[model samples]
Target: MSTISETYTVTGMTCGHCVASVTEEVGAIDGVTNVAVDLPTGAVTVTSTKPVSVDAVRAAVDEAGYSLV
Candidate 1:
């Protein structure tokens, strides 16, 4: 299988804890292999084995106590 990557915008992340939270939750999603968050730009890049669900991503962000914008 090939890797699928996506970038999403997130809001309300203020520090490293927030970054770790988002990374942990999103990285837990099935098939997710890598999660890179750019705090300065509020950009989250997710690399997975397959196309991930928007709803799942939204939920993961929510679990991290943040909003995906």
Candidate 2:
């Protein structure tokens, strides 16, 4: 399996709970294997077994009421 990591500047994460919510939502995608969010930095890291496309990731973030900046 291929491993890939991506960092996204996410908007709308104001607290740890928001981070957790975003993490869960993104992690639920089929290709996503791991997720980490730093609320203070507004950074979201995603690990996947395959090459997870930016559009797919952005769509998931958008669905969760957030934006991938």
Candidate 3:
């Protein structure tokens, strides 16, 4: 399988807990191999084996009490 990486901006993340929450939620998505959250910049990098939909990522962020910008 090929690795795919995508970066998305998120809002409402201000600390380490926020980072962890985003990571856990996004990482739970199917095909997701890794989730990296940059709290200072609110940039989330999702690495997966397949293309993950934007809607899926948005929903995951929402589920974590944040918004995908």
Estimate TM-scores for all models: 0.97, 0.89, 0.97
lDDT of 2 by residue, 1-69 (tens): 778998989998888778877888899888899998988888899999888888888988887788998
Itemize residue pairs with steric clashes in candidate 1.
none
Runs off by more than 4 Å, candidate 2: none
Off by over 4 Å in 3: none
Clashes of each: 0, 0, 0
lDDT of 1 by residue, 1-69 (tens): 789999999999999999999999999999999999999998999999988999999999999999999
Which runs in model 1 stand beyond 4 Å of their true positions?
none
Candidate 1 least-lDDT 10 residues: 49-58
Ranking under lDDT, best-scoring first? 1, 3, 2
Q: What is the alpha-carbon lDDT for the whole of candidate 1?
A: 0.97
Candidate 3 Cα RMSD after full superposition onto the native fold (Å): 0.6
lDDT of 3: 0.96
TM-score of 2: 0.89
For 2-68, candidate 3 gives per-residue lDDT tens digits of: 8999999999998899999999999999999999888889999999999999999999999999999
- Give the lDDT of residue 27 in candidate 3: 98
What is candidate 1's TM-score against the reference? Answer: 0.97
